[model samples]
Target: MDSTEVVVRSVRTVGPDTVALILESPPEFDARPGQFLQVAGEVDGEEIARHYTLSSPGADETFEMTVGIDPDGDLSPWLGEREQGDTLEVAGPFGRSYYEDEPRVVVLAGGPGVGPAVGIAERAMADGGEAVVVYRDDEPAHEDRLRGLEAAGATVLVTDEPLADSDDALDVLSEATGQVFVYGFADFLDDANDALAATGHDPDDAKVENFG
Candidate 1:
């Protein structure tokens, strides 16, 4: 939608390649899970705006995003350079937040894809939903955050590499009776969506987000 100025509030590392950013937005604006805001900054006289999904759950004027830093990645490095109090123009806490007050949920996150899924899970658990987080490469990707989920009463299922064929993942995913959310890179989109399909879940009951 529209853009607003936000100030950098903090930064923390979430994974080997992922950085979690905390931003202070206008008190009148509240951001939701799965929504991303475009943060724009000037790099060497050129302006760059990067869309980052909120990683931590918050309200009352704070927001977060877990961004993968590629050494050569333009938008990422620019975002990494921002510091506390630095102002950024952010627009549209955009994207349809894959969230509901449902009572049960299965969150499938692959790679740095845990960003949005973790955000979704946090909210679900707080609302008393039975939740599970299935992450690839486990602690290496989640570290203390996964522990936070466990503490919040979520069952975490982890798998390393060769991330089971789509079918195999589905076999494991079919156990959840409520909604399913699959979060991954762009390449995993269709396969994961199909996996949910094979489980007999309604396409509308499944939510998929691609971090390209």
Candidate 2:
């Protein structure tokens, strides 16, 4: 756990169900894409831990995480209540970074899943690889941030494609040559795999990251 204590610099609402948790990074913090922070705090007399995807691109000094509101959730509520100048504990950069310099990869994300996708795309962009991203039902506040993500050279697609009755996300995802990286609802992975396998897409190429 390459952990540190971060001071809460600001908190901004990104959508009805999401908020951007901005923190002042510790000195000499260097985190790669796909890594996460396990924030530990007390909520309602329980030892609570929530893993948040960092949104601060590159090795920036300001660490930020995109959090979705869970009405029945224990941690996000407390996290949402945090004001500027507060402090939070985080430990991480504790996983594999998104593939760098890989062939054309399809980034499939839903809601908060976009952060890691963008991080991966950023890494690919840095390595000069072709990357495409697809988002489903993005947070309203994040629309502006996401719409221009692809305009900076990467291809980004946003769709209302149903993960159930429609295979649109699947079709768009398969258009990429090499790989598909997906993150979001558990059922999304199942539906994606089912669609891919049914359509004869190579299941080996796409990697699924399910966080349940």
Candidate with best TM-score = 1
- The C-alpha stretches of model 2 lying farther than 4 A from their native spots are 101-103, 138-141, 163-168, 198-200
lDDT of 1: 0.73
Best-fitting candidate, scored by lDDT: 1
Can you write out model 2's per-residue Cα lDDT over 1-212, one digit (the tens) per residue? 56567898899987777888888878777676666778977788987888887665565768678888887998988998999998888887665535545756677777677777777776677676777877776343366556656666777777656543456655655565666777767866676566566655765677666766
Runs of candidate 1 with Cα error greater than 4 angstroms are 137-139, 162-171, 202-204
lDDT of 2 at 44: 80
Residue-wise lDDT of candidate 1 within 1-212, one digit each (tens)?
47878788998777887788888867567677767778787888998887777776565678787878889988888777777888788887777746766688787777766887788788888887877777765445556877888987887766664334544456666776767877778656555566566777665666777778
